[model samples]
Target: MTPAARVSAAIALLDDILQGAPAEKALTVWARNNRYAGSGDRAAIRDQVYSALRRLRSAAWAGGAGDAPTGRALMLGLLRQEGEDVDAIFTDARFAPVPLNDAERQMPGTAPEPVALDCPEWLEADLRASLGEDFVPVMTTLRDRAPITLRVNLRKSDPAHAAALLAEEGIATTPNPRAETALSVTDGARRVANSAVYRDGLVELQDAGSQALAQAVPVADDARVLDYCAGGGGKTLALAARVSAQFIAHDAIPARLRDLPDRARRAGVEVRVSDAPAQAGFDVVVADVPCSGSGAWRRQPQAKWDLTPDRLAELTALQSEILDDAARCTAPGGVLAYMTCALLDAENAAQIRAFATRHPNWTVTETRTSRPDADGDGFFLALLRAPAQTA
Candidate 1:
């Protein structure tokens, strides 16, 4: 497909997304319907769709739609913002976006702070409360694609060795400062899945912040660890790389962990997958619970628009419940790791504080909160110890 045709496809997909269709579903439908579109065309269209979604408000406003906008208007605004020639992509020719009229050709005026930063007005206050002075800057950063990062499985190979293996496959990487095992994909990021390093379990795709959080876990040698909510078992696997421990991964929905065994086998790690907590007295218990995912908007922009106050409250409640249960499962004097991929205070420190209030004997040993940046996604990890026994 031509570049102009890709933009047109993106406009249609965006319209579907705006009308309540999930971005993934809309893209899949578009792909199945347009069998003639090659892999390159599909990838380009997907990029355009996601890029526009990331900066929906700013793009819409710039396209002269002010507060009200359509998908076509949003794309026009996105091009305008990027300093691209609007006429080139919107030729009004076959399979191309309609040309901008005089009204759309006119440059947009200034928008409100939230709109200017591409943040929803309703979430502005909450985001500001969480991010403080970095709100605007952070939001601006989230309006772009996040860099791909991978965690070197030290059990198999070191970072340097892993980089060499990846380079052999035409995939380039650089050491990430966020974590000792973290590597940022510098080139051929799309080839990571097919790279020998990744296929051979030398490295696993993960956010640098997540790698840092995993490193922050104070897992002792031979300690038994329980991942309370091990969705896809990413953190569980990270912890496994650091310690020779007995690992058990459990989730509320067992289906979520269906592939964990295969993943563990590929990574050459032992992780017992369970639908429920089989036994208690774990040395370390990690509750990486449900969250609003405000910190990961750059990678999953649709989530930003789908989140609601009620859903956030539900997630916080669930997180608190999981923390409570996970704390109970920790062995006496064991460590409990409470974590989330959310920037909201209510989900991070606030939940920890509430846990402290409920169990004054449990004491916080360490707390780490990483803000979203060029190196990593935002994340929070709090390590607490169960009360020691007294004779």
Candidate 2:
């Protein structure tokens, strides 16, 4: 497909997304229908659609739309923002979009501050309050694509060795300073899943900050660890790499962990999948609770726009409940690690503070917060310890 045709395809997908279809679903349906579109064409069109969603408000403003912006307006707005010659892409030729109208050609003036920042209007105040001075920079970073990062399975191979193996398979990586086992994929990101290193269980696709969170948890040799809210067992797998621990993976929706067994087998680790919560006490219990996922919006841009105030409140409440439940599975003097990918204070430090307030016996032993950067997405981890029994 020509570049112009890709833009047109992206515009149609964006229209379907704007009409209430999910971005992924819309793109999948489009690809299934257009069998002629090659892998490269589909990837390019997907990128265009995601980029537009990431800057929806700014694109709408740039395209001179009022309340509801059409697909053409969004594409035009994005093109204008990039300072590209709109005529080249929107020619009246077949399979290409029509030329921009007079109104669209009359370049829009400066957009509202929030629109310019590509932040949701409702979330501006809370984001500013949570981030303070760094809100703009962090939000700006989220407007672009997130980097591909992998965590080396230290039990099987180190970062240097993993990099060497990946390089042999036409994939390039650089050691990331954010975490001991992290490797930032510098090239051939698309081939990572097929790389011999990844297929050989030497490396796994995980955020560096997440790897750091798993790394920070105190685990002794032969310690029993329970991943309380394990989804897809990524963190459980990361923990397995750090220590020779008895790992138990449990999620509220057991179906989420259905593939964990295969993943564990591939990585050459033992992870017991549990339908119910851990009945016995564990040395370490990790509750990577669900939240708004505000920090990792670069990868899931639709979530940012889909989140509502009520939904956020619900998530916070759920996080609190999960923390309390996870605490039950931790032995006295054991570590209860609460984590989230949200940057909101309501979900991170504040939740831990509230947990401490409710359960006086528990005390926060360690806390780590990371902002989204080239190394990883924004993440917060607070390790709380259960009180030791008194004689």
Candidate 3:
């Protein structure tokens, strides 16, 4: 498809997304119906759709849509922001967008702080407070694609070995500074999944920050660990890759773990699926509880707009409850790793502080954080040591 045609396709997909249909769902439906659009066309359109979403508010403002948003306006705004030739793409050609009128051709005024940052107005204050002097930079960084990172299963292969194997398959990689096991894919990323290295479990797709979080876990060589809220078991596999511990995975919604067993097999790790994880006596308990996913908005931009204050509050409440349960599962002298993919203090440090207040016996050990930056997505890890004896 021509570049102009791709822009037109993006506009239609954006309209479906704007009307409350999920971004993924709309894209899927469009692909199924427009099967004539080749793989490259679909990928290009997807990039355009996500890019616009990442800059939704600012793009709308650029397109002169102050209160109401439209697909055409968003595309125009995105082009304006990127300093692209709007006339070239909106040519009214057979498969192109209609040409811009005098109103659209005119430049728009400056956008509000939240709009310019593509953050929801209601969330602006909290994010600002959470990020402090780095708020602007962090939010601005979220307006682009996240790096495609892979976690080398150290049990099966090291980063150097993984890089060599990936290079043999045409995928270029650089070791991630955030975690020793992580590699940032520089080229041929689309082929990584089908590459020999990945198929044989030398590496698995994971964010560098997440790999760092797994590395932060303090465990004994023969420790018994429970991933209390192991959604899809990424953390579980990560932990197992680093240690020869007895690992167990569980989630409140059991169906979320349907693929974990296969993932474990591929990674050469044995992670027991547990339906009775609550009756735990674990040396390490990892609680990667759910959150607003604010730090990962770059990868899932639609969620950035979907999150509401109420939903955030509910998440914090749920996080606290999960912390309590995870704490219970931590054996005496064991470590409880509390973590989140949120940059918001309400979900990270503040939650840990509240948990400390609720459970006086659990002692906070160490905390590490990385706000979304050049290295990786925002992640928080806090280790708490249980009392030497269970009282």
Candidate 4:
């Protein structure tokens, strides 16, 4: 497809997304119907759509309105692309859009403020509270595409050997400092899903920060560990790799763990699935509950725009409930691990504070947080231990 044609495709997909279709769903439907579009064409169109979404507010402002639709966003992105004025492309000709009116032609194209730089206006204060003075820089980092990272299955192979195997398949990776087994795919990331390394389960896609978070949990050999909210079991797999533990995984939505068995098999790890609580108490109970995913807006920009104050409150309540329940599963003097991908203070520090207040017997033993500027998705982990019996 021509560059102009790709722009047209992005505009159409954006329209579908604006009309209530999810961005991924619209892109998938478009690709399915337009089988003639090659891989490169599809990738280019996707980049255009996501780039516009990441800077939606700025694109709207540059297009002369705060509510510019898909076509206007496309035109503004194109304007930034070739440094051409919007008038040059919207000529109302065949295979092109209608010409801009006199007002659009004269529209003021100014850059947006820091809040409008990446996230919506309503989330500004929350972001500030979460990130403090580094909010702008963190949000700026989230405006671009995230690097593709892979966690080597230490149970199967060491990082060096995995990197060598990936290199044999023409994929280059660099060891990530933030995660012991993480490899940042420096090149050939597009082919990773089909590569031999991925097929053999030598590596699995996961953020470095998540790997670090799992590593921070001190698990003993033969220790009984429970992943209480093990959605997709990524953290479960990571934890299993870290120790020879009696791993148990469960989730409120059992369907999320359906593929976990297969994933565990592929990764050559044992993880038992149970809907009911384990009869044996756990040495460590990990509650990686759901959250706003604020730290990962770069990978899923739509989420940032979709979050609301009320929804946030509901999530905090849920996090508290999960923490309370997970604490019960931890043996006396055992660790209760609370985790979330949200960078908001309400979800991270505030949630921890609330948990500590309600359960005074549990003392926070350790806390760790990762920021977008720190080479991984934003995350928070708190290790709380129940008080030992007094003599």
Candidate 5:
């Protein structure tokens, strides 16, 4: 497809998305209907759609007011955001989008300081509370795509061997200091799934911060560990590699763990999946519960825009409830690990503070917070232990 044609496709897809269709759903439907579109064309169109979504506020401001947001206007706004002139592509021709009119051409491009930053208006206060004076820079950074990373399955192979094997397959990766098992995919990310190392499950895709969180859990050989909210079992797989513990995974929604058995098999690890906790007592209960995903807005920009204050309040309540239940499964002298992918103070430090307040008998052993500045997604982990019986 011509460059102009790709722009036209992006506009149409965005229109479908604005009409209540999800971005992925709209893109998939468009791909299925347009069999003539090649892989490159589809990839280019998808990139443009996501790029516009990531900077929606800024793009909207640059495009000026219209009856509603059109694909053409969004593309124009996105080009302006990249400091590119829209005239080169939006030429008046058949099979190409119509050229920008006088109104669009003369539209003032200056963005209000806040909107230019591409953050929701209501979230400004919450962001400030979470990130302090660095909120602006942090939010700006979230506009970029996150790096693809892999966690070397130490149970099967070491990072060096995995890196060498990936390199042989043209997928480049560099060691990450944040997590010993982490390899930041610097290039050739598209080939990961087909790479011999990845296909053999010597390495699994995971963020460095997430790998760090799994590492933080103090696992002992033959220790009984329960993953209380193991959605998709990413952490469960990571934990299995770190220790020879008897790992049992459970989630409120059992469907989430359906693929876990297959994934565990691929990784060559044993993870028992169950809707309820196992009969045996647990030495450690890791509660990696749901959150607003504030720390990962770059990877899923739509989530940041979709979040509302009311929804955030509800999530905090649910998180506290999950923490309490996870604590119950912890045996005497065991540890309760609380985790979330939220950078919001209300969800991280505040929740930990409240947990400590309500459960005075529980002592916080260690609390760690990872920001987006480094090589991975933002995350928080808190290790709390129940008090031992006094003489």
Candidate 6:
């Protein structure tokens, strides 16, 4: 498909998304219906749709479609923002958007801070408070795509070895400093999943920040670690890859861990899947609780606009409950690692403080934070030590 055709397709998908269809759903349905659109066309259209969502407010303002941003306006705004030839793209050519009206041709003025930053209006205050001086920079970074990172399964290969193996399969990677085993995919990322290296589990797709969180957890030789609230077992696999440990994964909804067994087998790791994890006394218990997912908005920008204050409040309450439950499973003096991908303090440092307050005996050992960067998404990890047992 031509570039103009891709933009037109993105506009229609954006309209569907604007009218309440989920972005992925709209994109998938469009692809399925238009079987003529090749892989390249689908990828290009998807990129355009996601980029528009990431800059929704800014695009609306630029296109002078305040309050109600139509798909055409958003595409025009995105084109202008990227310094594209707006007139040429919106010409009378086949599959092209209609020529811009006089009103759209008018120069767009600078937008206010929140709109310029593409931040949700309701979230500006809390985001500013949580991010302080770095708010602008952090939010700016989130406007683009996130880097693709892979966690090398130490059980199968080391970072350098994995990079070499991947390079042979047309996937280029550079070692990521966020974690010892992380490799940031520099090129051929689309082929990574299907590459032999990934299929054989020499590398697994995981955020570098997440790999760092798993790396920071203290694991003794032959220790028993329970990944409490382990959804899809990403962190559970990361942890198991690092050491020879008896890893058990359990989720509140048992179905979330349905694929963990196969994933573990591919990575050559032993992981016991338990529905209840009824017993405690785990040497290390990781509670990677869910949040508003603000930190990784570059990957799922819709969440930035969809999140509500009430939903955030509910998440904080849920995080607190998960922390308590995970704490109970940790052995005396064992590690209780609290984690979140949220940029808000309410979910990160604030949650850690609340956990410490609730469990006065537990010690807040160490805390690490990573803002979204070229290497990884924003993440927070707080290592809390359970109180020693009494005879």
lDDT of each: 0.89, 0.89, 0.91, 0.83, 0.86, 0.91
Q: What TM-score fits each model?
A: 0.97, 0.97, 0.98, 0.94, 0.95, 0.97
Which portions of model 1 miss their true places by more than 4 Å?
A: none
Q: Write the per-residue lDDT of candidate 3 for residues 1-391, one digit (tens) a residue.
A: 8999999999999998988999999999999999999999999999999999999999999998875889999999998888899899999998999998988877878887878888889888888899999899999999989999999998888889889989989999998999999999999999987898998888999999999999888877899999999999999999999879999999999999999999899999999998888785799999999999988999999999889888998999999999999988988999999999999999999998998898888899999889998778999899999999988
Q: How many pairs of residues collide in each model?
A: 0, 0, 0, 0, 1, 0
Better of 1 and 4 by TM-score: 1
Q: How far out, in Å, is residue 79 in model 2?
A: 1.9
- RMSD values for the candidates in order, in angstroms, are 1.4, 1.4, 1.1, 2.2, 2.1, 1.4
Q: Which candidate achieves the best TM-score against the true structure?
A: 3
Worst 10 residues of 4 by lDDT: 73-82
What local lDDT score does residue 52 receive in model 4, on the 0 to 100 scale?
77
- Give the TM-score (vs. native) of candidate 3: 0.98
**Residue-level lDDT for 23 in candidate 6:** 98
Q: Tell how far residue 254 is off in model 6, in angstroms.
A: 2.5
Candidate 6: the clashing residue pairs are: none
Candidate 5: C-alpha RMSD to true structure equals 2.1
Question: Which stretches of candidate 6 lie above 4 Å from their native place?
Answer: none
Candidate 2 regions exceeding 4 Å error are 278-280
- Predicted structure 1: clash tally: 0
Higher-TM-score candidate of 4 and 6:
6
Return the TM-score for candidate 6, rounded to 2 decimals: 0.97
Q: Give lDDT tens digits, candidate 2, residues 1-391.
A: 9878988998998898888899999999999999999999999899999998888888888889844777888888888888888899999788999887787788878887788878988889989999999898998888888889999998789888888989988898998988999999999999998878888888999988889889899999778899999999999999987778899999999999998998888888889998876475898999999998988988899899899999999999999999988988898889999999998999998998899899987889899989998788999999998888611
